[model samples]
Target: MHLSFKNLFFTIASVFGIFAILILAKPVLIPLAFAFLVAFILFPVCQKFEAWGANKIFAAFLSMLSLFLIIAGGLFLFSTQIIDLSENLTEFKEKILEIFTDLTLFINQNFSFVPELERGELLEKIKSGLSNSVGTLVGQTFSGTAAFFTGLITSIVFTFLILIYRDGLVNALVQFFPENHQDKAHKMFKSVQQVGQQYLFGMFIIVLVLGFTNSIGLLIIGIDNPFLFGFLAAILAIIPYAGTLIGAAIPVLYAFMSYDSLWMPISIALFFWVVQFFESNLLTPKIVGGNLKVNAFTSILSIIVGASVWGVAGMILFLPFSAMLKVVCQEYIELKPLALLIGEKNYTDSEKDDKPGLLKKWGEKIKGWF
Candidate 1:
């Protein structure tokens, strides 16, 4: 009992210490984490370039340049649409006011206990609130853009250096383990790298597939800037389940404001729903495979914890980090339970222990036909 209590205390203390450090050191750690993940995805490409007669530095630069070009091109197009949208903000505000007035009137008529407020007074108050919010938002957006660009440069620099010194980094990490476990350490390193690359590459494919499909659907519905909204949604979809929902909101809001009829926004929502449903069920599994599969509950919890700890970057980073953690846990006897906790049910040892019944296996096979 005493030993168990001691172990419990140590576990709790360790978790808290790690969480505290993550929250406090986020400014530096966020970029480092971004660099690390980017390096994982880009290292193989750099090696390919080097094998083709390029030097390591040049290879790394080429890899970074390729990524920068893709991002810059997308941003250039998206920003153009955003500029157009901003020019018509006054029109959108007017439509919003009309909707708000209707909502207020309905509430006032339906409920007698509620105080009947003057439409002009209510509009004035709402206008003031929105004006303040817009001002704050614009200020934050400009400031944040500068910070984002600065961090992007830092991440690119770190990625290049990491690719150049990756061998040294691997050796240093392996040295942390004892001589007896050095082989296990090397295996762990390979497994983690494989997991990162697979997840990232799979996600990239998913984004392209989603972007193309979403653009087609939006165009069918006659939405403006279909490519911009589609690609933006696809990029944000990297954040897991919540990201799809969040991305869908962007186009839905624009459709709502741009069109006179409510049908456009409704159709956009339905289209996103259908696309997300298939992407989650079919595309993700087929391309990404089950290498990094975590249960939905754990995925959501990790995202929430990540957001709390490091805001947006944490949300993007923690899911892959958790998958890597699970991979490491699976190699060690003491940590196996943790691996089980974070992993998907179908992927866990419990499922392996009790050979799945024939009926269950058949069910899975039949379900896969969809």
Candidate 2:
């Protein structure tokens, strides 16, 4: 029962090697992961249909169809609005420039000993920078759009197949382990599914509420293109704090540019602040219900890391992935310490007792092996 150094080294290397592969394969895997996530989100609806006497295949098909239609309709509606907004960009830029000029003049008029550059030169530089930035942004947008459509098509096809043959996939995975471990494997799979489903459904509801509430508020504040801004905000809300901050900037900037009065932008900023306060304090808690036990700090850190590794897809996928990892660690005795480290204290009282501290357990194992 002696543990060899060679064996330990091999184990560590293997883990690292797998991680490397995952990083390298991220581009290919992103669509598949997205498909699985979408399927996971739709699982409850499929289950409800099944409960209502429909077969699994039929239920899945109906759910997918409904999702497709909703997405298509939203895209169609938004496309027209986006085109109109793009067409008015010249006017928007002019308004923004006027505001900038006014601010510059105010600063020069009010402040003493401030050396002022020629307004025309400054404006020209700003315009040149903005033009370059816009061109770069447009190029990136075209590339991103192409990538998104490609991923979307692949995800849709894969999701349909996955939903259709989900049972077979489970069975195949179960077959990978020994006969005695099949039950454990099944249990683990169930835990993953439960955590994923709960997270996805809860997040969906929360994001929808956020979008609608913000949209309504913006409309009330007389913001142009409220629906577009609100929708973007809601979608960005999926990324946690960063999403809200970025989402707020759009309307705030629009308010500042669209109106001559500073009061309007100030009011809009206040409105966004209130909406965000409500989301964090009220909506998130009521909807998500503390199932995701990661604290705010860890949640943000995980999102930043995930987004870095996987781009936007990473950010969206990271939350549920972390949740699933926590669930697995809680279920497996050897990995319990990891669960404790990743999860909030409120979510893991039983796990604390059931799973020993990681270092202690590892030390004992090493000693026993020797």
Candidate 3:
């Protein structure tokens, strides 16, 4: 294909235009995006039930029921710790005041001069600011939580619809391509579904393992609410790269504030470091790495773009979607370069042929059927 100024202008316009639409339509699109991803994960389960002679409605309901139960059980388990934590809000407030007071004193003694009355006024202002911010944050949190559940409900409904009509939905998508290429499009969709299933299932296992190990480590170090913090960290680990560090920071700082000894914080930090090291080096690379087959740059770029478009939700969803995008792109001549740009580099075709990931095996089966 020849690169032309008009074509370049159109491409740039299309890119920006799509982003504008994504931003404007986010309230609906975000939930729809999530629903599609969840549908992909649950579709195989639906199929399994159908294979066992269950009706599509029953199969979809069963899948959704299982998910709802898992979520409810998790929330139930966390409720006790949440209540305990809520009871300590007074202590947390005091800790914040103490920290602020210490900072003010340090500034007065070491960095600047302040009259006694001025110092008191400054401290009062700081406290008042924090109080207002905290109140605003609390309100925002409640509203955000409500919005989340609403979206979740919407996603569940969409997933059920997608599950029951998966064949028609897929056929609709495949119809977008030319008639001659529709068969290839169908195979690509199969690969996309296969990748989604593998990635999600592998991530579930990784999170459980990480949560168990983190809790055990924290328990050994005598951190309060070890399981709660451990699993919270594990869930945040879904964010990729910096997520582990961000997740670990909460409990480690809490440890510093809660324990009189310095070693408690040190131990919490150390535990997370070890877990992160192993997870980065071993778990992810071994488990879900093959599912994406994307290079570091593309994955990171997708995360950044996703975050910019949809905040944290984008960061979590975009990576796998990029992988799926790559699968579809590889089938089209015009977009194959995009696939090459995102995909892992293999020096030789022989090297790629030598090792087939699970996704490749499934994709091969899909292609075989066509």
Best by TM-score: 3
For candidate 1, lDDT tens digit of each residue in 164-279?
Answer: 99989999999999999999999999889877877777788889999999999998999998888898899999987778889999899988878889999999999999999999
Top candidate (lDDT): 1
Deviation from native of the Cα of residue 364 in model 1, angstroms: 26
Which residue runs of candidate 3 sit more than 4 Å off their true CA positions? Answer: 113-123, 132-135, 346-370
Relative to the true structure, candidate 2 reaches a TM of 0.79
Q: Per-residue CA lDDT of candidate 3, range 1-370, in tens?
A: 7779998999999999999999999989988988988887777677778888999999999988888899899989989988988898789877877777878787887766765635467668888888889988999999999999999888888889989899998999998999998998899888888777777766777899899999899999998888999998999998877588888998998888888999999989988998998987677666666436577888789889999999999999888888888887888899999888887753235353235454445545654332
**After TM-score superposition, what is the CA distance of residue 358 in candidate 3 from its true location, in Å?**
7.6
TM-score for all models, in order of appearance: 0.87, 0.79, 0.89
Q: Global lDDT for candidate 3?
A: 0.82
Show where candidate 1 strays beyond 4 Å: 1-3, 77-80, 108-116, 132-139, 345-370
lDDT of 2 by residue, 265-362 (tens): 88878988998898787666555555454666668877887787787778878777887888888877888987877777644455443333333243
lDDT of each: 0.84, 0.78, 0.82
What ordering of candidates by TM-score runs from best to worst?
3, 1, 2
Sorting all predicted structures by lDDT, with the top scorer first, yields: 1, 3, 2
* CA deviation > 4 Å runs, candidate 2: 1-15, 47-59, 76-84, 97-117, 125-139, 346-370
